[model samples]
Target: MTSLLRISTLITTLSFSGLAVATDVVHFEGKASNTLPEAVANFSEYNDKLEAVMEGELTPEAMSEVHQLSYTLENAIAKMSKELDSLAETLEEVHLASESADTETVSEQGAAYLETSRELVE
Candidate 1:
Protein backbone atom coordinates (compact mmCIF):
# COMPACT_ATOMS: atom_id res chain seq x y z
CA MET A 1 0.00 0.00 0.00
CA THR A 2 2.83 2.41 0.91
CA SER A 3 4.70 1.62 -2.31
CA LEU A 4 1.58 2.23 -4.33
CA LEU A 5 1.06 5.60 -2.63
CA ARG A 6 4.64 6.63 -3.36
CA ILE A 7 4.33 5.64 -6.98
CA SER A 8 1.15 7.67 -7.37
CA THR A 9 2.79 10.70 -5.84
CA LEU A 10 5.78 10.36 -8.09
CA ILE A 11 3.59 10.09 -11.14
CA THR A 12 1.68 13.18 -10.14
CA THR A 13 4.87 15.14 -9.59
CA LEU A 14 6.26 14.07 -12.96
CA SER A 15 3.04 15.01 -14.68
CA PHE A 16 3.13 18.51 -13.32
CA SER A 17 6.78 18.91 -14.19
CA GLY A 18 6.07 17.79 -17.72
CA LEU A 19 3.32 20.32 -18.03
CA ALA A 20 5.69 23.07 -16.89
CA VAL A 21 8.25 22.07 -19.45
CA ALA A 22 5.68 21.82 -22.18
CA THR A 23 4.46 25.34 -21.52
CA ASP A 24 7.84 26.88 -22.13
CA VAL A 25 8.60 27.79 -25.72
CA VAL A 26 12.12 27.09 -26.91
CA HIS A 27 13.41 29.30 -29.67
CA PHE A 28 16.24 28.55 -32.10
CA GLU A 29 18.57 31.52 -32.17
CA GLY A 30 20.77 30.16 -34.94
CA LYS A 31 20.38 31.77 -38.33
CA ALA A 32 18.50 29.73 -40.89
CA SER A 33 20.22 29.03 -44.22
CA ASN A 34 19.14 31.74 -46.66
CA THR A 35 19.91 30.25 -50.07
CA LEU A 36 18.47 27.02 -51.50
CA PRO A 37 21.91 25.40 -51.59
CA GLU A 38 22.62 26.45 -48.04
CA ALA A 39 19.18 25.30 -46.90
CA VAL A 40 19.72 21.94 -48.61
CA ALA A 41 23.05 21.50 -46.88
CA ASN A 42 21.55 22.44 -43.53
CA PHE A 43 18.67 20.06 -44.10
CA SER A 44 21.07 17.20 -44.78
CA GLU A 45 23.26 17.93 -41.80
CA TYR A 46 20.44 18.50 -39.33
CA ASN A 47 18.42 15.56 -40.61
CA ASP A 48 21.38 13.23 -40.08
CA LYS A 49 21.84 14.51 -36.58
CA LEU A 50 18.14 14.25 -35.85
CA GLU A 51 18.07 10.67 -37.13
CA ALA A 52 21.03 9.73 -35.01
CA VAL A 53 19.44 11.18 -31.94
CA MET A 54 16.17 9.39 -32.63
CA GLU A 55 17.84 5.98 -32.96
CA GLY A 56 18.59 5.96 -29.25
CA GLU A 57 16.25 6.17 -26.28
CA LEU A 58 14.20 9.35 -26.23
CA THR A 59 15.22 10.86 -22.95
CA PRO A 60 14.57 14.47 -22.02
CA GLU A 61 17.94 15.57 -23.34
CA ALA A 62 17.41 13.84 -26.66
CA MET A 63 13.96 15.37 -26.96
CA SER A 64 15.44 18.79 -26.30
CA GLU A 65 18.00 18.24 -29.03
CA VAL A 66 15.24 17.24 -31.38
CA HIS A 67 13.23 20.32 -30.57
CA GLN A 68 16.19 22.60 -31.29
CA LEU A 69 17.13 20.82 -34.50
CA SER A 70 13.56 20.91 -35.77
CA TYR A 71 13.66 24.67 -36.23
CA THR A 72 16.53 24.52 -38.69
CA LEU A 73 15.08 21.51 -40.42
CA GLU A 74 11.75 23.27 -40.84
CA ASN A 75 13.43 26.31 -42.34
CA ALA A 76 15.32 24.16 -44.81
CA ILE A 77 12.19 22.32 -45.82
CA ALA A 78 10.31 25.58 -46.32
CA LYS A 79 12.99 26.94 -48.63
CA MET A 80 13.20 23.71 -50.57
CA SER A 81 9.44 23.51 -50.93
CA LYS A 82 9.19 27.07 -52.21
CA GLU A 83 12.00 26.62 -54.72
CA LEU A 84 10.76 23.25 -55.92
CA ASP A 85 7.26 24.65 -56.47
CA SER A 86 8.67 27.27 -58.81
CA LEU A 87 10.88 24.70 -60.52
CA ALA A 88 7.92 22.40 -61.05
CA GLU A 89 5.97 25.23 -62.65
CA THR A 90 8.89 25.88 -64.98
CA LEU A 91 9.06 22.19 -65.92
CA GLU A 92 5.31 22.16 -66.57
CA GLU A 93 5.70 25.11 -68.93
CA VAL A 94 8.45 23.28 -70.75
CA HIS A 95 6.27 20.18 -71.08
CA LEU A 96 3.32 22.14 -72.41
CA ALA A 97 5.50 23.98 -74.92
CA SER A 98 7.04 20.75 -76.18
CA GLU A 99 3.59 19.20 -76.71
CA SER A 100 2.57 22.20 -78.83
CA ALA A 101 5.86 22.13 -80.80
CA ASP A 102 6.89 25.50 -79.43
CA THR A 103 10.61 24.95 -79.73
CA GLU A 104 11.58 28.37 -78.43
CA THR A 105 9.55 28.14 -75.20
CA VAL A 106 10.61 24.55 -74.67
CA SER A 107 14.25 25.35 -75.11
CA GLU A 108 14.17 28.37 -72.84
CA GLN A 109 12.17 26.77 -70.04
CA GLY A 110 13.99 23.45 -70.35
CA ALA A 111 17.37 25.10 -69.87
CA ALA A 112 16.06 27.02 -66.89
CA TYR A 113 14.67 23.84 -65.33
CA LEU A 114 17.90 21.87 -65.92
CA GLU A 115 20.07 24.62 -64.48
CA THR A 116 18.02 24.88 -61.27
CA SER A 117 17.65 21.10 -60.97
CA ARG A 118 21.38 20.53 -61.34
CA GLU A 119 21.96 22.69 -58.30
CA LEU A 120 19.78 20.29 -56.26
CA VAL A 121 20.97 16.99 -57.78
CA GLU A 122 24.63 17.76 -58.27
Candidate 2:
Protein backbone atom coordinates (compact mmCIF):
# COMPACT_ATOMS: atom_id res chain seq x y z
CA MET A 1 0.00 0.00 0.00
CA THR A 2 2.82 2.41 0.78
CA SER A 3 4.54 1.63 -2.53
CA LEU A 4 1.31 2.20 -4.45
CA LEU A 5 0.82 5.50 -2.65
CA ARG A 6 4.32 6.62 -3.55
CA ILE A 7 3.79 5.70 -7.19
CA SER A 8 0.54 7.65 -7.30
CA THR A 9 2.24 10.71 -5.83
CA LEU A 10 5.07 10.52 -8.31
CA ILE A 11 2.64 10.25 -11.21
CA THR A 12 0.70 13.25 -10.03
CA THR A 13 3.85 15.32 -9.71
CA LEU A 14 4.99 14.35 -13.17
CA SER A 15 1.61 15.11 -14.71
CA PHE A 16 1.52 18.59 -13.23
CA SER A 17 5.10 19.28 -14.21
CA GLY A 18 4.41 18.25 -17.79
CA LEU A 19 1.42 20.56 -17.89
CA ALA A 20 3.55 23.36 -16.52
CA VAL A 21 5.86 23.10 -19.54
CA ALA A 22 3.34 22.92 -22.35
CA THR A 23 2.01 25.99 -24.17
CA ASP A 24 -1.00 26.57 -26.43
CA VAL A 25 -0.57 26.17 -30.18
CA VAL A 26 -1.41 29.10 -32.39
CA HIS A 27 -2.51 28.69 -36.02
CA PHE A 28 -0.96 30.53 -38.97
CA GLU A 29 0.72 33.04 -36.73
CA GLY A 30 4.47 32.67 -37.35
CA LYS A 31 6.60 34.10 -40.17
CA ALA A 32 8.01 30.60 -40.70
CA SER A 33 5.44 29.94 -43.42
CA ASN A 34 6.24 33.09 -45.34
CA THR A 35 10.00 32.71 -44.95
CA LEU A 36 10.03 29.17 -46.26
CA PRO A 37 8.37 30.16 -49.53
CA GLU A 38 10.75 33.05 -50.00
CA ALA A 39 13.70 30.82 -49.27
CA VAL A 40 12.50 28.32 -51.86
CA ALA A 41 12.19 31.03 -54.44
CA ASN A 42 15.67 32.25 -53.64
CA PHE A 43 17.02 28.73 -53.98
CA SER A 44 15.42 28.39 -57.41
CA GLU A 45 16.89 31.66 -58.57
CA TYR A 46 20.29 30.74 -57.19
CA ASN A 47 20.16 27.40 -58.96
CA ASP A 48 19.36 29.08 -62.24
CA LYS A 49 22.29 31.42 -61.84
CA LEU A 50 24.52 28.50 -60.92
CA GLU A 51 23.46 26.67 -64.07
CA ALA A 52 24.28 29.68 -66.19
CA VAL A 53 27.67 29.97 -64.55
CA MET A 54 28.33 26.32 -65.19
CA GLU A 55 27.49 26.70 -68.85
CA GLY A 56 29.68 29.79 -69.30
CA GLU A 57 33.44 30.18 -69.13
CA LEU A 58 35.29 28.86 -66.10
CA THR A 59 37.28 32.00 -65.28
CA PRO A 60 38.85 32.36 -61.82
CA GLU A 61 36.55 35.24 -60.82
CA ALA A 62 33.49 33.45 -62.15
CA MET A 63 34.41 30.29 -60.25
CA SER A 64 34.94 32.30 -57.07
CA GLU A 65 31.54 33.97 -57.36
CA VAL A 66 29.91 30.62 -58.09
CA HIS A 67 31.48 29.17 -54.97
CA GLN A 68 30.24 32.06 -52.88
CA LEU A 69 26.71 31.86 -54.25
CA SER A 70 26.57 28.11 -53.69
CA TYR A 71 27.72 28.52 -50.12
CA THR A 72 25.19 31.26 -49.46
CA LEU A 73 22.33 29.20 -50.90
CA GLU A 74 23.31 26.14 -48.87
CA ASN A 75 23.42 28.14 -45.66
CA ALA A 76 20.12 29.82 -46.36
CA ILE A 77 18.42 26.48 -46.99
CA ALA A 78 19.84 25.06 -43.79
CA LYS A 79 18.69 28.04 -41.74
CA MET A 80 15.23 27.89 -43.25
CA SER A 81 15.03 24.17 -42.53
CA LYS A 82 15.97 24.74 -38.91
CA GLU A 83 13.32 27.42 -38.59
CA LEU A 84 10.72 25.07 -40.06
CA ASP A 85 11.70 22.34 -37.62
CA SER A 86 11.49 24.71 -34.68
CA LEU A 87 8.04 25.88 -35.75
CA ALA A 88 6.79 22.31 -36.22
CA GLU A 89 8.13 21.19 -32.86
CA THR A 90 6.57 24.19 -31.18
CA LEU A 91 3.25 23.44 -32.84
CA GLU A 92 3.33 19.85 -31.65
CA GLU A 93 4.20 20.93 -28.14
CA VAL A 94 1.36 23.43 -28.17
CA HIS A 95 -1.03 20.74 -29.36
CA LEU A 96 -0.05 18.40 -26.57
CA ALA A 97 -0.30 21.22 -24.03
CA SER A 98 -3.71 22.13 -25.33
CA GLU A 99 -4.93 18.55 -25.03
CA SER A 100 -3.85 18.62 -21.40
CA ALA A 101 -5.14 22.21 -20.91
CA ASP A 102 -1.75 23.71 -20.09
CA THR A 103 -2.37 27.27 -21.19
CA GLU A 104 0.81 28.78 -19.78
CA THR A 105 3.10 26.44 -21.65
CA VAL A 106 1.16 26.91 -24.85
CA SER A 107 1.38 30.67 -24.65
CA GLU A 108 5.09 30.67 -23.93
CA GLN A 109 5.95 28.28 -26.74
CA GLY A 110 3.74 30.15 -29.19
CA ALA A 111 5.42 33.46 -28.42
CA ALA A 112 8.89 32.00 -28.65
CA TYR A 113 8.05 30.37 -31.95
CA LEU A 114 6.73 33.59 -33.39
CA GLU A 115 9.81 35.47 -32.31
CA THR A 116 12.17 32.90 -33.73
CA SER A 117 10.29 32.86 -37.01
CA ARG A 118 10.41 36.63 -37.27
CA GLU A 119 14.14 36.54 -36.71
CA LEU A 120 14.50 33.96 -39.43
CA VAL A 121 12.59 36.18 -41.82
CA GLU A 122 14.81 39.14 -41.08
Candidate 3:
Protein backbone atom coordinates (compact mmCIF):
# COMPACT_ATOMS: atom_id res chain seq x y z
CA MET A 1 0.00 0.00 0.00
CA THR A 2 2.86 2.39 0.85
CA SER A 3 4.65 1.59 -2.42
CA LEU A 4 1.41 2.11 -4.33
CA LEU A 5 0.91 5.45 -2.61
CA ARG A 6 4.49 6.53 -3.43
CA ILE A 7 4.06 5.60 -7.09
CA SER A 8 0.82 7.51 -7.25
CA THR A 9 2.44 10.56 -5.74
CA LEU A 10 5.32 10.38 -8.21
CA ILE A 11 2.95 10.12 -11.15
CA THR A 12 0.90 13.01 -9.90
CA THR A 13 3.97 15.16 -9.47
CA LEU A 14 5.22 14.35 -12.97
CA SER A 15 1.85 15.00 -14.64
CA PHE A 16 1.40 18.37 -12.93
CA SER A 17 5.02 19.29 -13.69
CA GLY A 18 4.60 18.38 -17.35
CA LEU A 19 1.74 20.83 -18.00
CA ALA A 20 3.92 23.97 -17.75
CA VAL A 21 6.25 23.52 -20.71
CA ALA A 22 4.13 22.09 -23.46
CA THR A 23 6.03 22.29 -26.77
CA ASP A 24 4.11 22.61 -29.98
CA VAL A 25 5.68 20.01 -32.27
CA VAL A 26 5.19 22.10 -35.38
CA HIS A 27 8.13 24.41 -34.61
CA PHE A 28 7.16 26.55 -37.66
CA GLU A 29 10.76 26.67 -38.87
CA GLY A 30 10.05 23.78 -41.15
CA LYS A 31 12.94 22.34 -43.18
CA ALA A 32 15.31 25.23 -42.47
CA SER A 33 18.09 22.72 -41.90
CA ASN A 34 17.98 21.59 -45.54
CA THR A 35 21.17 22.91 -47.17
CA LEU A 36 20.27 25.15 -50.13
CA PRO A 37 23.54 26.77 -51.17
CA GLU A 38 25.26 23.45 -51.71
CA ALA A 39 22.40 22.22 -53.86
CA VAL A 40 22.35 25.44 -55.94
CA ALA A 41 26.11 25.27 -56.47
CA ASN A 42 25.92 21.70 -57.72
CA PHE A 43 23.15 22.57 -60.15
CA SER A 44 25.12 25.56 -61.37
CA GLU A 45 27.94 23.23 -62.26
CA TYR A 46 25.51 21.00 -64.16
CA ASN A 47 24.21 24.01 -66.06
CA ASP A 48 27.73 25.06 -67.02
CA LYS A 49 28.55 21.59 -68.19
CA LEU A 50 25.36 21.49 -70.23
CA GLU A 51 26.20 24.85 -71.78
CA ALA A 52 29.69 23.73 -72.73
CA VAL A 53 28.43 20.48 -74.22
CA MET A 54 25.68 22.19 -76.17
CA GLU A 55 28.02 24.91 -77.38
CA GLY A 56 30.26 22.24 -78.96
CA GLU A 57 32.93 23.23 -76.45
CA LEU A 58 32.44 19.65 -75.22
CA THR A 59 32.38 18.38 -78.83
CA PRO A 60 29.13 20.39 -79.08
CA GLU A 61 26.37 17.87 -79.66
CA ALA A 62 24.44 18.75 -82.79
CA MET A 63 21.18 17.86 -81.05
CA SER A 64 22.05 19.21 -77.52
CA GLU A 65 19.36 16.96 -75.95
CA VAL A 66 21.57 16.28 -72.92
CA HIS A 67 22.45 19.97 -72.66
CA GLN A 68 18.76 20.85 -72.55
CA LEU A 69 18.26 18.32 -69.76
CA SER A 70 21.07 19.95 -67.76
CA TYR A 71 19.42 23.35 -68.24
CA THR A 72 16.26 21.95 -66.68
CA LEU A 73 18.22 20.65 -63.70
CA GLU A 74 19.78 24.09 -63.12
CA ASN A 75 16.38 25.79 -63.09
CA ALA A 76 15.07 23.22 -60.64
CA ILE A 77 17.98 23.90 -58.32
CA ALA A 78 17.31 27.63 -58.32
CA LYS A 79 13.65 27.06 -57.53
CA MET A 80 14.49 24.73 -54.67
CA SER A 81 16.92 27.22 -53.12
CA LYS A 82 14.30 29.95 -53.18
CA GLU A 83 11.75 27.61 -51.57
CA LEU A 84 14.16 26.64 -48.77
CA ASP A 85 14.86 30.29 -47.94
CA SER A 86 11.15 31.04 -47.79
CA LEU A 87 10.55 28.05 -45.52
CA ALA A 88 13.33 29.06 -43.11
CA GLU A 89 11.84 32.52 -42.77
CA THR A 90 8.36 31.08 -42.20
CA LEU A 91 9.65 28.89 -39.40
CA GLU A 92 11.36 31.82 -37.70
CA GLU A 93 8.05 33.66 -37.71
CA VAL A 94 6.29 30.68 -36.15
CA HIS A 95 8.89 30.38 -33.41
CA LEU A 96 8.45 34.06 -32.66
CA ALA A 97 4.71 33.70 -32.45
CA SER A 98 4.97 30.88 -29.94
CA GLU A 99 7.43 32.79 -27.78
CA SER A 100 5.33 35.96 -27.83
CA ALA A 101 2.25 34.22 -26.47
CA ASP A 102 1.26 35.31 -22.91
CA THR A 103 1.66 32.32 -20.62
CA GLU A 104 3.27 33.60 -17.40
CA THR A 105 1.42 33.77 -14.07
CA VAL A 106 2.37 34.26 -10.35
CA SER A 107 0.75 31.61 -8.15
CA GLU A 108 2.65 28.42 -7.22
CA GLN A 109 0.69 26.44 -9.79
CA GLY A 110 1.07 29.19 -12.32
CA ALA A 111 4.83 29.42 -11.74
CA ALA A 112 5.23 25.70 -12.09
CA TYR A 113 3.11 25.73 -15.21
CA LEU A 114 5.13 28.62 -16.62
CA GLU A 115 8.43 26.85 -16.03
CA THR A 116 7.13 23.66 -17.55
CA SER A 117 5.76 25.54 -20.55
CA ARG A 118 9.05 27.34 -21.07
CA GLU A 119 10.93 24.09 -20.80
CA LEU A 120 8.67 22.49 -23.36
CA VAL A 121 9.23 25.40 -25.76
CA GLU A 122 12.96 25.41 -25.16
Candidate 4:
Protein backbone atom coordinates (compact mmCIF):
# COMPACT_ATOMS: atom_id res chain seq x y z
CA MET A 1 0.00 0.00 0.00
CA THR A 2 2.75 2.41 0.83
CA SER A 3 4.58 1.60 -2.41
CA LEU A 4 1.42 2.16 -4.37
CA LEU A 5 0.87 5.52 -2.72
CA ARG A 6 4.42 6.57 -3.47
CA ILE A 7 4.12 5.59 -7.10
CA SER A 8 0.91 7.56 -7.50
CA THR A 9 2.45 10.59 -5.83
CA LEU A 10 5.49 10.40 -8.09
CA ILE A 11 3.32 10.16 -11.17
CA THR A 12 1.31 13.18 -10.13
CA THR A 13 4.42 15.21 -9.46
CA LEU A 14 5.90 14.33 -12.83
CA SER A 15 2.67 15.23 -14.59
CA PHE A 16 2.55 18.64 -12.95
CA SER A 17 6.19 19.27 -13.76
CA GLY A 18 5.56 18.59 -17.42
CA LEU A 19 2.62 20.99 -17.37
CA ALA A 20 4.79 23.68 -15.77
CA VAL A 21 7.45 23.28 -18.41
CA ALA A 22 4.84 23.59 -21.14
CA THR A 23 3.50 26.76 -19.59
CA ASP A 24 6.98 28.20 -19.22
CA VAL A 25 7.61 27.57 -22.89
CA VAL A 26 4.67 29.83 -23.68
CA HIS A 27 6.14 32.55 -21.50
CA PHE A 28 9.50 32.18 -23.21
CA GLU A 29 7.73 32.34 -26.54
CA GLY A 30 6.28 35.70 -25.56
CA LYS A 31 9.70 37.06 -24.55
CA ALA A 32 11.35 35.66 -27.66
CA SER A 33 8.76 37.46 -29.76
CA ASN A 34 10.82 40.65 -29.52
CA THR A 35 14.34 39.38 -28.97
CA LEU A 36 15.33 38.52 -32.57
CA PRO A 37 14.44 41.82 -34.21
CA GLU A 38 16.14 43.79 -31.46
CA ALA A 39 19.30 41.71 -31.82
CA VAL A 40 19.38 42.32 -35.56
CA ALA A 41 18.97 46.06 -35.16
CA ASN A 42 21.71 46.16 -32.55
CA PHE A 43 23.94 44.11 -34.79
CA SER A 44 23.49 46.53 -37.69
CA GLU A 45 24.14 49.58 -35.54
CA TYR A 46 27.21 48.01 -33.98
CA ASN A 47 28.53 46.91 -37.38
CA ASP A 48 28.14 50.42 -38.79
CA LYS A 49 29.91 51.94 -35.79
CA LEU A 50 32.70 49.40 -36.07
CA GLU A 51 33.10 50.11 -39.77
CA ALA A 52 33.31 53.85 -39.20
CA VAL A 53 35.91 53.32 -36.52
CA MET A 54 37.95 51.12 -38.81
CA GLU A 55 37.80 53.58 -41.70
CA GLY A 56 38.90 56.48 -39.53
CA GLU A 57 42.20 57.14 -37.69
CA LEU A 58 43.67 54.48 -35.36
CA THR A 59 44.26 56.07 -31.96
CA PRO A 60 44.42 54.01 -28.75
CA GLU A 61 40.95 55.11 -27.59
CA ALA A 62 39.44 54.53 -31.02
CA MET A 63 41.00 51.07 -31.15
CA SER A 64 39.55 50.27 -27.74
CA GLU A 65 36.06 51.41 -28.82
CA VAL A 66 36.30 49.44 -32.02
CA HIS A 67 37.23 46.29 -30.15
CA GLN A 68 34.30 46.78 -27.79
CA LEU A 69 31.89 47.32 -30.67
CA SER A 70 33.22 44.23 -32.44
CA TYR A 71 32.70 42.18 -29.30
CA THR A 72 29.13 43.47 -29.00
CA LEU A 73 28.40 42.59 -32.61
CA GLU A 74 29.77 39.09 -32.14
CA ASN A 75 27.55 38.59 -29.11
CA ALA A 76 24.49 39.73 -31.04
CA ILE A 77 25.25 37.35 -33.89
CA ALA A 78 25.76 34.46 -31.49
CA LYS A 79 22.45 35.19 -29.80
CA MET A 80 20.68 35.25 -33.14
CA SER A 81 22.23 31.96 -34.06
CA LYS A 82 21.17 30.36 -30.81
CA GLU A 83 17.62 31.59 -31.26
CA LEU A 84 17.56 30.26 -34.79
CA ASP A 85 18.77 26.88 -33.66
CA SER A 86 16.09 26.73 -31.00
CA LEU A 87 13.48 27.68 -33.57
CA ALA A 88 14.65 24.89 -35.83
CA GLU A 89 14.43 22.33 -33.05
CA THR A 90 10.95 23.50 -32.12
CA LEU A 91 9.85 23.24 -35.73
CA GLU A 92 11.13 19.69 -35.91
CA GLU A 93 9.30 18.80 -32.72
CA VAL A 94 6.12 20.35 -34.06
CA HIS A 95 6.42 18.31 -37.20
CA LEU A 96 6.97 15.11 -35.28
CA ALA A 97 4.12 15.87 -32.91
CA SER A 98 1.76 16.44 -35.81
CA GLU A 99 2.89 13.28 -37.52
CA SER A 100 2.11 11.40 -34.35
CA ALA A 101 -1.28 13.12 -34.03
CA ASP A 102 -0.38 14.81 -30.79
CA THR A 103 -2.29 18.01 -31.35
CA GLU A 104 -1.59 19.54 -27.95
CA THR A 105 2.14 19.04 -28.18
CA VAL A 106 2.13 20.24 -31.78
CA SER A 107 0.32 23.44 -30.83
CA GLU A 108 2.72 24.20 -28.02
CA GLN A 109 5.78 23.53 -30.14
CA GLY A 110 4.29 25.44 -33.05
CA ALA A 111 3.74 28.50 -30.88
CA ALA A 112 7.33 28.30 -29.68
CA TYR A 113 8.62 27.94 -33.23
CA LEU A 114 6.58 30.90 -34.45
CA GLU A 115 7.90 33.14 -31.68
CA THR A 116 11.50 32.19 -32.35
CA SER A 117 11.07 32.50 -36.12
CA ARG A 118 9.56 35.95 -35.74
CA GLU A 119 12.55 36.97 -33.71
CA LEU A 120 14.98 35.61 -36.31
CA VAL A 121 13.33 37.36 -39.25
CA GLU A 122 13.27 41.12 -39.78
lDDT of 4: 0.76
Global lDDT of each model? 0.91, 0.72, 0.52, 0.76
lDDT for each residue of candidate 2 in 23-110, tens digit (9 for 90 to 100): 4322231112246656666666778888888898989778766866776577558767877887889988888998999999899987
Question: Which 10 successive residues of model 4 have the least lDDT summed?
Answer: 25-34
Residue 96 error, candidate 2, Å: 1.4
Q: Which stretches of candidate 1 lie over 4 Å from their true place?
A: 1-18, 29-31
**Two-way TM-score contest, 1 vs 3, winner:** 1
TM value for model 1 = 0.80
Per-prediction TM-score to the true structure, in the order listed: 0.80, 0.45, 0.31, 0.55
Please identify which of the two predictions, 3 or 4, would achieve the higher TM-score against the true structure.
4
Ranking by lDDT: 1, 4, 2, 3
Q: Pairs clashing in candidate 3?
A: 20-116, 20-117, 21-116, 21-117, 28-91, 29-91, 56-60
Better of 1 and 4 by lDDT: 1
Steric clash pairs (candidate 2): 22-105, 22-106, 23-105, 23-106, 24-106, 24-107
How far out, in Å, is residue 1 in model 4? 98
Top-TM-score structure, candidate number: 1
lDDT string, candidate 1, 14-58, tens digits: 999999978887888554878888888999999999999999999
Quote model 4's TM-score. 0.55
